[model samples]
Target: MTKPDNPNKTRFGFETRMIHAGAAPEPVTGARQTPIYQNTSYVFHDADHAASLFNLQSFGFIYSRLANPTVAVLEERLASLENGRGATCCASGHAAQILTFFAFMEPGDEFVASNKLYGGSLTQFGKTFKKFDWHAHLVDTDDLAAVRAAITPKCKALFVESLANPGGVVSDLEPLAEIAHQAGLVFIVDNTLATPYLCQPFDWGADLIVHSTTKFLSGNGTSMGGAVIDSGTFDWGQNDKFGGLTAPEPAYHGLTFYETFGDLAFTTLSHMVGLRDLGATMAPMNAFQTLLGIETLSLRMERHCANAQDVAEFLAGHELVAWVSYAGLESDPYHGRAQKYLGGRAGSVFTFGVNGVTGGYEMGMRVVESCELFSHLANVGDARSLILHPASTIHRQLTDEQRDTAGAGPDVVRLSIGLETLDDLLADLDQALHRAAAEGDKAAE
Candidate 1:
């Protein structure tokens, strides 16, 4: 076991941070890799120490639900990669959203969100949020005027995705952040699709970021995890908007998070309060797996982007194809935004459509079923190719207008490009599309 030189003070490049940030050699055995602290509880040295840990006066492993050492390493590593002050890991992407909202919202408050987002997120915001009397105003985030108009006195946050999921629109972050700031609302960007490898939303004025680590962060799709990272620049105490952070926490004997934790107030409260009670905590083993995935993120993303470009190009010229919606394409409407925020790559997951409404739907399904290499699954950001018709699967809960507005129309098929060789991947699409076209031809009779 080799002792790593000071993980806390270590400063390196993005790639280096992805691999070594927050990762220290094991104190007991000097293990080079982060060890999974799978135990449920940690021993408190004395009565004073226990009180200190419980009161948030000191930071140490208290319980698995509150925080685990292995998960803490992952949280720190991801926060460093994204240039955030700190981060908290959650059980799933949806949990991250809920926990983040818990920091700035109470019953009856509303927030503006992008209409075009992952299907699961739309459901979470549209349906689940209603249960708590919280509301989500889903609008076109691309429309600056609409976003500005949507904000109300009760609005607490502006939420949008940096690189949208199936829609693949590269959101205009700079202006939207300004709008949120002007209205005294927190700006939260879901950096799931682009990951930290592609886009850093905080640099574009976003105050906080959320990610579905289950997707790209765990590049291999081996673990289920999510994260909420705070830029630590949002002055929660600057205004009366964030009572949850600036006010005394009843759970912690009136400790105001912003007064005590300062820049890290959001993440600290999320861990001590939200995660403690909600219990949507990431497992130590999953965190360890996500750490392993982060180690190869840059490499995987480079290949994933290149492969996606190739796939998108191949589909665009196909006779059966109608339109493609990846920002990586030079002709894409979002190309400029992608260049500005995503550093020239539109990201891996994108949507495309075939010709007809009824016929196109059949062809899209056939192509998905015919694919021998690309899997027909709901997940994205895997090292392997994936295909799904979002209209019937992920977006089945929404109405026709909602589905169409979200770019999940009946004729559309979403693709999550992977790291497979260019030739083999192209051949797979060719076969799938051909089979799909043949099926359509037979149906015409």
Candidate 2:
């Protein structure tokens, strides 16, 4: 195994870290790649070692649910990529959200989130989270005043997507983070769409960053995983709100996580308490696959962004398209923000409205159905292009107002541009749009 010289001491570049961070030559065979340790349990050194592991007195793998060698490597790499102090890997993105909230929020506490979020996240926060007495106030983040107004004494955090899904809505992170910090609330940014390749949330003052590795992080769409990376700068002991971290725990014989783990308190709590009790552990195999996927993330994202820009430009000029919501476009509302945060590369996943004689829903559906190249599915960030009518699919459960607010209206057709030949992708979309327009014309008559 060729390893980076002084991996721990040297500050390697992002590309180097992606391949070598949190990894070393296999002790037994000197393997170059990270091996999937698919065991459920690990052997304890002795009786005292077992006790220490159980008591949270020391850090060692006791159960797969709490921690695993494969998942640990994934977590460390993600933290390094995000420039975070630590990270915890879980089964899915939703699991990462739950683990994050579980650490700081008690029952009846609340958080504020941008109205523009993933449809599943909207459902999770607005509906399912209510069942647990954890409330989320969805507000338009563009209205900074509205965001501040939404926060109250019970608000524990402020959440926003760095680059919102379905639509390419670029958030102004610096201000939002300022708002959260000024109010003594944790600022959580979901960087799923932009990925660390395009935007690093921690650099913009985000205290915690979340990702559904199911998307860009696992570019091939083969692995399902999520991660919550902690900046490890939040002062959990600064206020009484984070009792879960600062206060003594009954489960661990009164170990205060903030005191014991310091900057890594959130990450430790996620593994020790959240995963241990919630049982949303990331499979070792999934972790291994995701790690492999991340190896080519920079390459994939560069291609993804470049291809999406071309597609978006083509659609903006096409007769069958109404409007394109890609921040890469110069006319986009979020263009300046994208330039500031994403270095002018506004990710691959974005939405556009299809022009129809009768209605947009029908035309959008037709376009999606007629697409020969883009896969018709709910997923985004695949190596292959994907298409979906979010109003009828992902956001079908939400009200009309919720759908529109989330940028997934009846007129919207979301596209996840892939790393395909630009000419081929454009040709596919041109045919799909014309076919859909003709279908709509026939229906109108």
Candidate 3:
């Protein structure tokens, strides 16, 4: 085990922390990597110890469903990556979103959310979330007035994607965070597309940062997982907005989380109550895979960004392409915001129009079909390139106006650039575009 000089002091770089942070050599066998504790239950030293753990007096593994050493390390690793006080791993990104809201909202309480979100998230909020009486007011997050208007007395949180899905639009986070704070709302950002390697939402005033680790964090696309990072900066005890964290609980013998756990209150509460009741815990095996993936996060993201920029540039000037939506491109509408918040390299996932919104939609489908290097699928952030026609697949549930408003126009093609050589990826796209153009000409003839 490599003990840090101090918990409060961070001396190592991000890449170094990705591999060794929250990990220790196995005491018994000197295992260098985090070993998966696949058991369902852990043995307590005695009844006193069990009571101590159950009462939240001390931290120890009680059940695999709530906490596991392997999973804990993954959580800690994620927390380290985000420079957060803590993080909780869950079954999926969708589960993370629900659990996050559960921390602050009761039934009938509402939250404000960005309209430009993953299709799954939009459906989860617009459709499924209503079942819980947890309402969401969706608006264009970029519109400051709309965002301010969305907040009401019942608004408990503000949610948005750090790097929006489909369109790859970068959310202007600082001002939004200020808006959320002025209203006493928890600012939650989905950092799935950007990952911690690209952007740390906490640094920009986000109280909570969420991730779909199934994407870039797993790097190889072998696992499905989600993570919720707590910045440990939000003061739940300040008001009734986060009563679940501030109030004494019937669930845990009237122990208040904010009082008991201090900065780590939200994370502790989510682990003990949210995972226990909701049963959306991430498995030990998946956690291990995600940990492995994060070790190379910095490296893979560099390549992903480089390849995506090249592809975006090529498509911007292509005769068959009408426009590109990558923030890395100088011509992109989001380039300014990207430069201000996301550093110079605007992540790997982006969208482009093959022809025009009308003709492009048809070409988008054919191009997706014709692509050889890029896998035509719904998931993004894999080491292998991926392509998805959101208008037909992910965003099919949304109406035409909704889809277009969210930047998933019928002609838009979302690409998750990978670690493949730039030449190979561009060549694949070139061939696919030519094939799609030929089919279009034949149909026109």
Best model per TM-score: 2
Tens digit per residue, CA lDDT, model 1, 134-181: 899999988899999999889999999999889998889999999999
TM-score of each: 0.97, 0.97, 0.97
Q: Give the candidate number with the greatest lDDT.
A: 2
What order do you get sorting by lDDT, best first? 2, 1, 3
Candidate 3, residues 251-302, lDDT tens digits: the string is 8878888998999899998899999999999989999999999999999999
Better of 2 and 3 by lDDT: 2
Which stretches of model 1 miss by more than 4 angstroms? 1-11, 356-358
The C-alpha lDDT values of all candidates are 0.90, 0.92, 0.89
The candidate 3 region of ten consecutive residues with least summed lDDT is 1-10
* Candidate scoring better on lDDT of 1 and 3: 1
Off by over 4 Å in 3: 1-9, 356-358
